[model samples]
Target: MSPDQFHDRMWEILQDINKNEFHAVAAKPPTDKAIANLATSTGIALPKDFLAFSQKTNALCIMAREELWPEAKLFDVGPAWTFHRGLVILGIEAEDLPEWANIQNAYESLVELYELTDVLPLLKIMGDGNHYWGVKQDGTFVEVFDGEATTLECSFIDTYATEIKELIQRQKDMCELITKRNKKQH
Candidate 1:
């Protein structure tokens, strides 16, 4: 699916989840200025598809209990750095950088990695903020686990479409389980 299709379908899924299951926060679209600021601060060029995604919805937060995977939570441009921080920390250790150094050094490492790999931190995967769902420079999605980037099986839109569908199915399963228990109780 294209970015627009993904955006529309994601909103539809969120609306259904909001009406049926737990609360899932869908933030407002971000302004161009906001996106520009993020790019400047991070020193990484944001891909067009990702910029479009940000333009459609700034963030999507799933409640801890409501997450499809134990590690599924997405953030928008503003809070995206929260996930990047994890990457920085991971790089400090994974790359075996000495613990005693200027913090700026760590940040520089992250910027360089992003630039060299063409990967941008897009969302936090785990509620605890350890992992991230990063988008590649080519519009494909990747999972950033402990600062290591691995391409996912599909593109960004397909990945999200799959996620939303799974979330809806999980909601249905939970509802059925609840009704079945209630029937037995009565």
Candidate 2:
């Protein structure tokens, strides 16, 4: 799909998830200045498709759990979860953004930590802060696992669309399983 089409598809999926299952936060579109600043700060030429996406939503955070599960109380732990698992697409840093959602910060840190050359970090899968998908300076996509980078044949936009869809589906499946377990218990 074209970049614009991919953006529309992504928004549709995110909206569906937000309306039915979990909460999702999409930041406002970044301005030209913010995009330019990101490029200058990172010293990497941003991809055209990525630029198109940034224009739609500067950042996204989809919460995995909207409320605490009752099962947690059985484990003698506080009724609170320490971390959430979901998807994150880092975008240009804005005033309202959390530091973790800042693309420039993540890109620079990951590149330096991994000794990765000519790659730009973009997406964090499973909210692990370790697995990532990034664009190389050559305009190709790479998957980074535990700081190791592997080039993927698909374009950045296509990879983004596919991965996001898979993650959403996995989350839905897990939720269904939980519901089944709860029903059996009662």
Q: List lDDT for all candidates, in order.
A: 0.48, 0.70
Superposition error at 32 for model 2 (Å)? 2.9
lDDT of candidate 2 over 85-185, digit per residue (tens): 46778877676777788788788778678776577888876436777888878777889888888989876656666766665666666666668878999
lDDT of 1 by residue, 1-186 (tens): 677866675566455454434545445555566556555655556556555655654455444243422232454332332222111111111122233221223334445655334555555432233355556556667776666778888665555555555555655665565477679999
**Models, CA RMSD each:** 11.2, 4.5
Please name the candidate that would achieve the greatest lDDT relative to the true structure: 2
Clash pairs for candidate 2: none
* Residue 55, candidate 1: alpha-carbon lDDT: 61
Query: In model 1, how many backbone clashes occur?
Result: 1
Off by over 4 Å in 1: 1-3, 12-18, 64-118, 138-140, 165-186
Candidate number with greatest TM-score: 2
Runs in model 2 with CA error above 4 Å?
1-3, 12-18, 68-84, 176-186
